[model samples]
Target chain A: MQVFKVYQQETLKYFHSIAILLFVTVGVSAQTKTDTTETKKKPTSFVPTGVRVGTDLIAIGMTRYVDSYKGWEVNADVDFSRYYLAVDVGSWSRDYDNGAEIYSNNGNYFRIGGDVNFLLKDPDRNMFFLGLRYGRSKFSESLQVNKIDSMWNNNPVNERYSNSNSNGSWFELTTGIRVKIWKVIWMGYTARLKFGLTTNEDGNLIPHDIPGYGRTDKNVAWGFNYQIFVRIPVRRQQ
Target chain B: MEFGLKAVNLSLQPRVSTMKKATWFIFLLIIIASCLNDPDCFRINSNVIGISFRVMGTGKSDTLRMYGVTTQNTDSTFYRNTAATGIGIPLDFTTTESEYLFQTTRGDYSIALKYDVNVQFVSEDCGSKYVLENLETTGHTFDSIRLVSRTPGTTAGGNIEIFRCPRTDTMAVAFRQLTLSGTTKSSQALVVETNGITPDFTGETLYGGEKVSIVYLPVNLDVDKHAMVIDFDQVEGGLRKLDLNYTLTETQRYRPCGVQIFASEMIINAVESQYAFDSVGFVLNETNSSIRSVLDPFDPMINIYRCPDLDIAGIYFRNRQDRADSTVSLKSVTVNFQTTNYAPTEPTTFIRVPLNKSATNTTVTIEYQTGKIETLVLSYTATPITRFRVACSDQNTLFTNLAVVAQGTTLVGSQVPNASLQSIPTRNIEIFP
Candidate 1:
C-alpha cells in the first residue's frame, strides 16, 4: 500500500505540472487568436529590418522609496536585423528621503544590443524574444531640503545639493512576447534577468539594482517590463 | 439556398464592423484637430481724449474771455470752429462760468461798470450771483470794467446800465482808500445815481502826479478798457481816496453815456534797455530807454549782442515791456565777451539805445593788433513801438503807443586804407562796446 501511495503521489505531481503548462499555453493561445483576427482585417506591411523605435517606463525600487521614469526610445539594428543600437532619454522625480525632502534625475541612455526570437508554436504569435542589451545608463541626482535642519544646533537652514552625473555599462537578457492589438497598436510584456558585469564596492560583479546603478538589484536579478505602442508604417511608392 | 444565406451573413457582418471602426477613427481625428487649432487671444484698451482753452488780454484787472464745449466723446478727431462768431473754444473751459456763458452766445462781451469803476453786482433775473471784491490791478495804469446786474430778484432780465465819478464824492471814501477807520467801510454805501443813470462803486488810482484829462473815447464793447487816475493835489500828501460808486438804470437798450473823468496823472517812470552787440567787436554801452513819470526807478537790460563775424545773443527785459507788480530796479550791467575772425570782410555792427542813453557822448575806442585796418561805422536806430493799445471810456477816447527810442552812435579808431564807411538808417539795431 505504501508503494501504491508513492506511485499515486508521483502521478498527481506529473498531472499538476502538465496542468500548469496547459494553463500558460491556453492563455497565450487565446490572446494570439484575438490578435490574429484583428491583424487580418488590415493590410500587412513589411516590418523594417533595420530600425526599431520603442518606449519604456522604469520603476525605481529602493529600500526607502520607489519612483517611476517614462520616456521614448529609438534603435537601429546594423548587423543582421538582430543587432541593435539604441538611445533612450527619460526624466524622473522622487520623494525618497521623506515627504520633507525630494530627489530628481534625468539623462539619455544608449545601448548596442543583439536579440533572437524563438517561435514556440506553429503560429508566429507564440514566440519568446531573448535579447542582450549592452548600454551606458547615465544618471544625475538633485536633492532639495524642504524643511529646516533639525539637529543639535538651534539654527534653521535650508539647503540645495546636486550631483553632476555617473555612468556605467550595463548588460541584461530580456525575454518577452509581442502581441498585436490593432493593425498599428501592439501590446507586449517582458522579463529581464540582468547582471552588472561591472564591480560594486565588494569587488564582485555588481547586481543590476543599486542606489547608483540603473537597476534595482545585482546578480541573478529579475524584472518584469510591459509596454503598449503604435506602429506608424511608412508607405512605399508604387 | 443555405449556402447563399451563409455567404451573405459572413460578408454583411465584416462589412458593418469595418465601417464602424473607420467612422470612429475619423471622428477622433476631427476632435483632436479642432482642439489643437483653437487658442485664446487678447486686445488692448482704447485711449481717452481731452481738451483745453486759453484767454489772452492786457492789464492785471482786464477781464479774460474764454468759451468751450464737451461733446461727451473721447475721440480726438472731433473739433469745433468758432472763428466766425469769435466763439471757437476748447472743451476744457466748461468749468468756468465766464467761459460757459461765452460758449453759449456768439456776441461780444464787455466788463460791466457800476460807477466809473468795474464792479460785480447781483441781478434778480440771473439764477446766481458772484462778486470778486478787491480786484487786483495790472502794474501799468489801465481801465477795468466788468458786467453788473441791478434787479432786486434773482431774475434781472432788463438791460443794466453803469456810470462813473470821482471817489472823493462817495460816502465810503475811506473804503475806497483801502483803509478801515471809524467808518464801517462798506462798498455798498458808494452806490449813487446821477443824470438819470445809476452806477456801481469802483476804485481808481493814478500812478504819477501827471494831470488827468478826459475826452470822448470810442468804446469797443467786446474789448472794454479802463483808465484810473490819482491827483496828488486832490488828496492829503498824495494819499487820496480811490472810492467810486455805480448805479444801474433800466433802459430799453444798453448804452454807455459820456466819458467821466475820475483822476488824471502821469504814469510812473519805468524804462527798459534792449541792447544788442555789434559785429565790429563791440558791446552795447546802452540801448533804448522808455520814459514816464518818476514814480518807480528804471531797470536797464542788455537786449542782444553780436560778435564780429559771429552770432548775436541777448535777452529782452520782460519787466520793462510788460507790467508787473514787483519792483524791478536796475542793479548792475554785465557784458558777455566773444571774438571771431573772418578774412576780407568789412562788418558794420549796429546798436540801438533808449533816447539819449547810447554811447554817442561816451568814449568808444577800437584797437586792432593783428588784422588789417577796416572802416568802422557806428549807427543808431529808434526803438519801434512793441505794442499799440486803444483805451475807451464813456467820456474819453485815447490811444497809447509804447516804443523804444534810439539816440545816436559815435565811432572811434583810425580807418583802414581804401575802406569805405557808411551809416545806414534802420529800426531796432544794437551796437554795444
Candidate 2:
C-alpha cells in the first residue's frame, strides 16, 4: 500500500510539470504574435490631459538681489502624447547705472515653441526635449550719456534720449530636461541658443539688453533658465 | 521606495560632479572674459607714426641741421638735435590728407602722405583705436623715401626713410653776448631781422629809448635789412673781420591787396681780405610753394606776410666800391638795441617802434687791443624808410656791382629756384653769419 501511495504522488508531480510547460509555451507564442502584428497609433482621446506651469526660479533670484534689475518669466506647457507645446511670457525692466551713463528699459516679451519629448511612456512623466521658439519683445529705452574725458576739448557734453520705442524678434533652439521630484512638483533646466531676427536701430542709444535675448551687440546670444514647475493632470493621475 | 531612493542617488551622484565642473567653467568664462557695459566714448583715436633724422652726409656730420617741423599750428623743434632720434607724430583721424612743413635755417619744404584709415573696436575699457594702412608718400622733400616697415607698429625702428645730402654750408661763428658757459667758444644772441612781415610781431629796429640784447623782428617793409657783424674775438693772432661773403637771392610774392613780386640778390664785397667770409647776410627765400589756407595762416601754405609797408632793401656796401684797407670790418662793428619790455636797470627793454618811427639810437662800440674802446653813435637822419640787407657766400663777390662781378646763385628756394612767386604770406629774412 505504501509503495502504491508514493507512485501516485510521483505521477501527480509529473502531470503538474507538463501542464506548467504547455502554459508557458502558449503564453510566449501568443505574446510574440501580438507584438509582430501590433501597429503603433495614438488614440483619439489625446487632448493634452496634463499641463505643467513653471517659473524661472533662477531669474527670480537674480532680479531680486541684483541692482536696477527687475524681471520674471512664466512657462506653461500642454502635452499631446510625446509632444509638448509651451509658451513663455516674461516682462523685464532695468535701471542700469554704470557711472558713465544710465540706461533704463522696461519691456514685455512672449515666446511660443513646441518641444518633442524624447522620454516616452515614463511612469514619472519626465521628459528630455529638443525645442524651438520664436520670441518677440516691445520695449522702451531711455539713456543719459555723460561726456567722456577728452584731450582736445573740456566741455560737458551730455546727451539724453527718452522713450525710444523698439521692437525685436529672435529665433531660439532649446535643449532641456525635466525631472519629477515630488508628487505634483518638477524641476527643469534649459539652455538656449538665440539667433537674431530683426531689431530697431538706435544711433545714439544702442540697446544693451533685449527682453528675450541677452545683448544686441552680436548676432547670436545665449540664455539659461532653471525652472520649478507645478504639474496638474486633468484626466490622468500622477 | 527606500531602496529605489538609494538607486536614484547612485545614478545621479557621478553626473553631479561633472555638471559642477562644467558649470564652474562656464561661469568663469562669462564672469571674467565677458565685456561689460562700458563704451569708449572717444569716436576718434589717432595712430602714432614715428619719424627720425638720418644724414646721408659722407662727411661724418653729427646730426641734420633742421630747425623744426610744423603742422596744424603745432611746432616740433629739433634744436641742434637735442632730442630723441625718432618722433612718433600723430595722424589726423578726421581727414585723409595731411601736410607737414620741414624747416631749416636756409629753407623749408613740405611732406605729404596718404593713407586709408581703419577703425577697430577693442574692449570696453579701451574703446577703439585707429589703424592707418596702405600708406604711400604723395609728396616729399627727401631724395629717397623708402618704407622700412610695410605696416608701422610701435617699434623704435624707423618707418619712413628720408635721404639727405651732406651739409657743406654750415659754419661755426660766435655772438658777442656772454652766457654762463661763454668763453669765446659758442655763438650767442642770434639776431633775426625778418623783413616783408608786419614789424610788430617781433619788434625789429630799436631807435631811442629801447634796449635789447636779442632781436627777432617782424617786418612788412619790402626794403628792410639789418647790418650784422661777426667777430673773431677768440683768435690767438690779430683781430680780423668775418669773411661771410654769400649771396641772398629770393623768390617772393606779395599778393591780395597790392605788393609786387620781388626777386633780388644781395651780395657782400670780399675784395682783398685775408679771411674767406665777410659780412653775414643772405636772402632766406620763402621756401613754401603753396597758397594761403583759411584754417592756418602760419603754415607753409603762404610765404608772404601782410605787413603795413613793403620796403625791399638790398645790400649796397657803402665802401665796397672803394675796397680800401681802412674800411669797416666786422671787428669794428658792435650793435646795441632795446627790448619790448621795460627793464629799469637794463637797457635791453624795447617796444614795437615802426620802421618810420624810431625807438632808440643804436651805439656801435668797437674795442681794440690794450684796453682801447671806441664808440660810434649813428645819429637819426629823418627816420629812415628802409634798412639795407646784406648777404655773402664767397669773399670774391663782395666787389662793386657796377664792376660786372659774377652773381652768386647758391641761395635757392627749397621748393624750386625759380618757382612762381604769387600770393605768398610769409617773410623770411635769413642771416648767414
Candidate 3:
C-alpha cells in the first residue's frame, strides 16, 4: 500500500506540471500574436528623403568663429536641387551713438553662389545627413542727419544730410548635422562661414572676414553662419 | 463533482443575465433619447376650445336676437338672430359690453351697427345689451334731444311792422299831435324839442297792450312823398285834435347823392410858387330839390378850417335839406392851415374866408410856395353821414382831387377840369412864439 501511494502521488504531480505548462504556453502565444499584429501595422519610412529641393530653408542657431567673433545668427538658405544651386540671405545690425551709427554697417544682406553639402554631421553625436544650399552675404547702410539754426536769423533754417544707399555682398558655404526627432520632422544645426572672393577698390572688404580664409588683408572676406533646420514630412506608407 | 459544476455554472449564468439586462436597459434609454432629439418623429394633439358671440347691431338697442352661438368652422364667421344659427357645440364662454355700446360676447366678440347710430353696451348678470340714441349723447349714458329753429328778434311793447330795406336807404317819421297840457307851448315849439317830439323808434318796446302805427318805405321817395311829411298847421286845438292819415311810398330822390373826384399829378411847384396845369380831374354832378340854397348868393362854398394844435386842418359844411336826410351842402369856402409845433390846448381857430362868388360849377386853385400841415380833421354839420372815405397821394392833396368825400355831404352837378399843381410839397413844419 505504501508503494501504491507513492506511485499515485507521482502521477498527480506529473499532471499538475503539464497543466501549468500548457497555461503558460497559451498565454505567451496570444501575447506574441498581438505584438506581431501591432508591428505589422506600424508605418515605416514616414518621411521622404531629399525633399528640401528648391526650398527656402531658414535656420536659427548659435554661431561661433573658429578664430574670431561669436554670436547667434539666422540664415535663409535657398536651394535649387536641379542644378545643386544654393544661396544664403541674412543680416546683422549694431548701433552706437544712440542708434545713429546703425546705418554705418547694418541693414540687409544676400549671399550668392555657395557650395552645397549633400551630407553633414554632428561630431559629438556622430550623426550625419545630406542637404543643399546656395546664397550670399550682403550689407546695406543708410544715414541721415538734420540740423536746425534759429539763432542765425529771425526765421528757422533747416538742413538735411543723408546716405541713400551703401551695400556689399559675398558668397557663403554651410555644413552641419541632420537629426531626426519625429517620423517626418528633422532637426539640424550648422556652422556656416562666408567669404568674399572679390572686393571693391573703396576698401569695403577691409573690415569683412571670409568663411574659409579667416581674416585676410588680401581683400578676401569671411563671416560666420549657424543654423537649425526643421524638416516637414510629405507622405508615408504603412 | 457534478453538484459543484452546476453551482459554478449557475453563478456564471446569473452574472451574464444581469449584464444582458443592463444592456437592454441602455438600448431602451438610447431609443428614448433619440426620439426626444427628433422634431418630426411624433405629433401631439391638443383640443383648443373657446366661445364667441355675434351681435346684430352695435348699439345699446341692438337686439341680442340670438344666444349660445358658435363660430363657423369654415371661415370663423358668426351667425345672427333669425338670419343664422349656431351648429350646436360646447365651448368656453364669456361676454362683455363696452361703455360705447359695443357688445362683445365671450370677451372676444365684436359688434357692428347699421346706420350712423350712437350705442352704449351694458353687461348684466343675464347677458350683455347695447343702448342707442338718435341724438349725440355726451358726458353720461343717457339719450339726448336737440330743438332747433330761427330765433326772431324780441318784440315787447306794441305790434309794429318790421321790414328789411336796402342798406343805403334812410328811414324817417313825421307826426302831428295836439296836447292840452299848457297854453303857451305851441306845436312848432314841440317840433323843435329834441326830447319831447322825438319818437322812440326802437325795435323793442315796453308797453304790453298799446299799439302803434308804422309805414314801410323804400329808398325811392318820389313814388310816395305825401305820406312822408306831415303838416301840423292844419290841425286845430282847444282840447287839441289832429288828422293822422298817411300813405307810404318809395322814392329815389330822397337818397343822398354825391360825386367822386379823382385827380392825377396835381403837383405843387415850390420854385414857381404857382399852380401847375391840370392833369386829371372828375366832376360829381348831382342835385336834390330837398337841399335848399342856404347861401344868399346861390353859390355853394366849401369852408376850410385849421385846427389849433396843427394836428387837424380841413373844411366843413352843413346840409340845408331836411334834417332827416343824411346830406350836407358846401358853402362859404374857408382855408385853415396847420403847423407841426402849433400847439393849441383846444381846436385851432385859423380859417380861410371866401373872397369871390362861386358859380354852380366853379373851379378854384390855391397855391402855396412852402407850407406844412401835420394832420387834417374835417367836421360836417348837416345830415348824419352813413359812409365816407379819404385818399391822398404826393401829387394831389385836394379833397375833390383825392376822391375824399365827406359824410352827409352831397355833390351837386358841376364839372371841374383836371387842374394840376407842380407838386404837393410836404415840410416838417415848426411853430414859433
Using alpha carbons, what is the TM-score of model 1? 0.23
lDDT tens digits, residue span A1-238, model 2: 4335434544543443344334333433443344334434445345677889999987799898987778999998988876789999998887766555566778999999998765454457676666889999988877665654343224353556554568889998776677888987999876665776687744334566778776664455667788999989887732
- What are the lDDT figures for the candidates, one per model? 0.29, 0.47, 0.25
Ranking by DockQ: 2, 1, 3
Task: Tell how far residue A166 is off in model 3, in angstroms.
Answer: 3.3
User: Compared with the true structure, what per-residue lDDT tens digits does model 1 show for residues A1-238?
Assistant: 5335435544553443344335434544554454445433444333443333444433323212433333344333322222233333333332334454444545555655665543222232323355677656565545444443222122232444454454555676554555446665655654444456453222111122232224332223343445554544443311
How many collisions per candidate? 78, 50, 54
lDDT value, candidate 2, whole model: 0.47
Best by lDDT: 2
Q: Tens-digit lDDT track for model 3 on B302-380?
A: 1111111111222222233431212222222223431222232333322222111121122222221223222222222
Please give the fraction of native interface contacts (Cα pairs under 8 Å between A and B) kept by each candidate.
0.00, 0.00, 0.00
The runs of at least 3 residues in candidate 1 whose Cα sits more than 4 Å from the true structure, single-residue gaps closed, are A1-52, A57-100, A120-126, A144-161, A197-222, A230-238, B1-433
CA lDDT, candidate 1, residue A134: 65
Instruction: For candidate 3, write residues A33-53 as lDDT tens digits.
Output: 543443334343323333332
lDDT of 2 by residue, B1-433 (tens): 3553222222333234433443454344334223332333443343456666544422121233456666652333324333334555565543455677766653676678777654433333443344566666788876445566544443334567664443222222222221111111122443222221112323433322223223222212233233223322222222333322223223222121132222112233443455332233221325732221111111111111111121111111122234322222232323355323211232211111111123223343433323344433322322222211222121111111111112223212111111111111112111111
TM-score of 2: 0.36
The alpha-carbon deviation from the true structure for residue B424 of candidate 3, after best TM-score superposition, in angstroms, is 99
